[model samples]
Target: MAEDMSNEHSQDDSGLHAWMLAWYDHAVSVGFIRPPFLLNDVTAERLEGYFRVGLTPVEGAEAFFGVAH
Candidate 1:
C-alpha cells in the first residue's frame, strides 16, 4: 500500500509524507480534536512500524519531524 503511494511522490517527500500522516493519526488518537499540522496515508502502516520498534509518540515525532529549534 505504502509502496504504491510512494511511487507517486519523490522518494524523499514520500517518507516525509508518511511520517506526517503517522504523526497526525497519533495526535488524533491521543485526543487532539484535529491534527496538529496539515498532513495530507500509509499512516497506519508507518505508525505500526514505529510501535514495532518501541518508539513512543514523542520519540517518533522527534525522529521524523525533528526537535523544534
Candidate 2:
C-alpha cells in the first residue's frame, strides 16, 4: 500500500524531507513513460508501479530514468 505523504512536508522531522523528496523524485521519474492515451483510465496504482520500477536501473533505460529528461 502507498504511504500517505499529504502532510509529509508539514512535519518538522528530518525524515519527512527524505520521504517527500523520494515522492517527488518518483513522480518525475514516471511522468515521462508516455502513456498510450491521455484520456485512458489511468490509476495511481499503475502509475505507482511505474514509478517504483523506474527507480531501478534497467537495460536500455536512461541513467536517471525519466526524471532527468
Candidate 3:
C-alpha cells in the first residue's frame, strides 16, 4: 500500500507517508489512543511532506480530522 501512495508523478510524498500510516494502524491494533510517535521535525525528510498526504498531524490521532500541518 505504501508503494501505491509514492507514485512520483501523481503525488511526490516522501516515504514518511508510509511510515506514518503504518504507525497509525499499529497503534490502533495495540489499543493506543495516543501513540508516542518517533518521527519529528528532526527526522522528517521535509516539512511539506506532512501536508501532501491525508493523515492526522499526530500519528495514531485520538480524533479524526486532526491537524496534518
Best model per TM-score? 1
Kindly give the number of clashing pairs for every candidate. 0, 0, 1
Would you give me the overall lDDT of model 1?
Answer: 0.60
User: Per-residue alpha-carbon lDDT of model 3 for 1-69, expressed as tens digits?
Assistant: 767765763544444466567656755665654656565664354423443454444533433324556
Q: List the residue pairs that clash in candidate 3.
A: 57-67
Write down the lDDT of every candidate, Cα atoms only. 0.60, 0.41, 0.50
Candidate 1: lDDT of 50? 72
Ranking by lDDT: 1, 3, 2
Q: Over 4 Å off in model 3, which ranges?
A: 1-12, 34-69
Per-candidate TM-scores read 0.39, 0.29, 0.31
| Cand. 1 TM to true fold | 0.39
lDDT of 2 by residue, 1-69 (tens): 134474553443444334334554544466635424242334434433444454332321333333563
